[model samples]
Target: MPVQKMDVFDVIVSGAGPAGATTALFLARAGKKVLLLDKEKFPRDKICADNKTWKCLDIVKELGLWKQFQKLPKAEIYGVLVASPNGSEMYTPLHEKDIAERGHWYNVKRIHFDNLLAQAAKKEKNITFKEKCAVVKPIYAVHSKTHISGVTYHDAKGKTHDAWARVVVGADGSQSPIAKAVGHSPVVKGRYATNTRAYFENVKGPMDRCELYYLKGICPGYFWIFPVDKKTCNVGIGMRPEDFERQKKSLEQILRETIALPQFKGRFKKAKQVTAFKEWGLSVLGKRRPCAGNGWVLVGDAGTFAMTFSGEGVGPSMRTGKIAAQGIVRALNENDVSARNLKKHYEDALWKILNPEVKGFRWLEFLLLNERLFDFVIAKSAKNKELIEISSRMQHDYTLSKKLVHPKTALKMLLS
Candidate 1:
């Protein structure tokens, strides 16, 4: 593609992660000239577990990248093993079609998975996917000085340049420049989580199932071991910032101690941690934040779409990217860039799908976080198929989220 005027872009997307790349792919398909910018290079390493919700897969398919995804290395998972703080354990089978379109869930490393999205965006003729270019600040129109005009960025070699667009999409992570420009705060204590991710090899456990252990001090969050293949598994622990601070131990130290507990003695005796543990921050939607403003909109972590209870990210990121693109396509046609315009066209549509979900699951999060109740529920679910089924459906199925907080459901889980 030949260089054009700096102002020739329909949309400028900040960050080439899942949300930005997916948004660019969709907008390009809609015939928009898109500039997808990222500070990192392609095939960059992101510290994360090997879990991809079927919804994430659906977006990959929608972008016509399914065939490419199929060729990547992954583990086919069919069920989950959940253990309580007191060591009570339950195994719940995840049914196909109910949870995923592929009839199985997939677990692939973030390094490979994210790079695939960036590559797909580059394939679009209308998209200029510029890696190693970091957006420095927003350029506001002089007249309004409220809506975005474009952005100034520094390239890989630190050369500064200005790029303009009719609309700007902030698909950047939690600390998005565009989001800040629109008066958004990056982290609020209750709505955020910190996670430490690592990989382990030669683990002794069921290779086809995901394992989650609810630990003391880390209510709602869990230490998870997800299979990446026959020999390797992605392992991690997630906790609210407050919980992590209270523990007063490094994530690496806590992880090691937890593995030494009698309940996990057998599983990790032969296992070797294959990667250094890395800690990162995540913003979850315990409460929704405004996403659209004057000439700009936020998606993915910038919008706080990670599930409140599960700390889920990839699926929601892709989902918002695709949904936002639909609204942006309409906005482009209508030539409206006001905050109110995008509030109706984009934000409303997004929250309609997300509002109830995060609100309902926070109830589930509160209920199961108590150590005694966590133990009781796992013990009962082990013997009662109904309890196990309902527990499995609490996620991926939204109908039960509201009921999960009902007094009847709480009593049923406790007494029945």
Candidate 2:
């Protein structure tokens, strides 16, 4: 672990996923030299259903990547279908349109989507791409007792290289080496909350619809089947670690029982596992705290910006990266890299944009955990046209506002 010879960059991004790629894109576009490093090569794959909502689309457009984004094979997910443990069901469609205003969201394979974004990042003149480079640790200065100056990494050939940057972005994700090297402790405990996901292919269904089955007693979590393509889908269940402990069943067992439900048994008969089962402990959420110190910041799952209820992070992660890039660029322009100054970017921009949504999602998570309320919503949702319409809209703010009905509204929904 001798410090390797260093090459300098304005920004050294540790992860080449959506967040890191987008951050590099923004930074490079601003004329800052960026070195983007990733442990995986291009066309790398990741777990999770690959879905992007308008929250992410806006950033794609801002980065002038909308057109390319459109070229990918995308299935328009009309809305989500939710079923209660008791068998009652509801469908919610997403609202928003592209050119013709046809659909509000798109689903594509992450392998393709992530590589596409990274390719876009490569097109930037100021970015130097390094794939298969595993970051070892953050290069820190003893004097400041703050700020990560660079990173030391090992390449596929066992060659070690060090790269220095004015600022470091730990977009390296949940198991971030840079985050750990910088003295950031893992807040997510494996014993408390953990998630398991399994990916399958050749599932029978309309590619445009994703389904969520809410099981009673499994509060704050749901079973999901997200279609990635005509032939593939992400079938998984995420619940409290305590639930798994109590039941003492494997993740696959829960998932198999879920697929055996009458609604899915026939449709998923042809499905096959394309990837091995995967499990990861989610990072503990940092509600309003600044994710950056003096010279480094963490984005994406590394910062646990995933929605507590939905477990959706792709859009928010990319958005956070863009906002982080903006902050870093501004700090560089002002010749200050202090955490206090850089904190303004997250405080004024990133958190403000996502805080309400996170709070709303947290509330929904709690409500879903309450079996009485879960049952009430499912039963009422089937008959409540207003609830159905609002649910279909896919706007978190609107949905949360309307869904938190008062007694009068509740009466109206249930009676009507």
Which candidate leads the pack in TM-score?
A: 1
For model 1, residues 192-216, the per-residue Cα lDDT tens digits are 7788878889888788888888887
- TM-score per candidate: 0.94, 0.91
Q: Output the worst ten-in-a-row residue range by lDDT, candidate 2.
A: 95-104
Q: RMSD for all candidates, in order, please.
A: 2.6, 3.0
Clashing pairs in 1: none
Report the C-alpha displacement of residue 303, candidate 1, in angstroms.
1.5
The model with the greatest lDDT is 1
User: Candidate 2: global Cα-lDDT?
Assistant: 0.77
Instruction: Return the lDDT, model 2, position 289.
Output: 50
Model 2 segments more than 4 A misplaced? 1-5, 96-103, 187-193, 284-286, 394-402
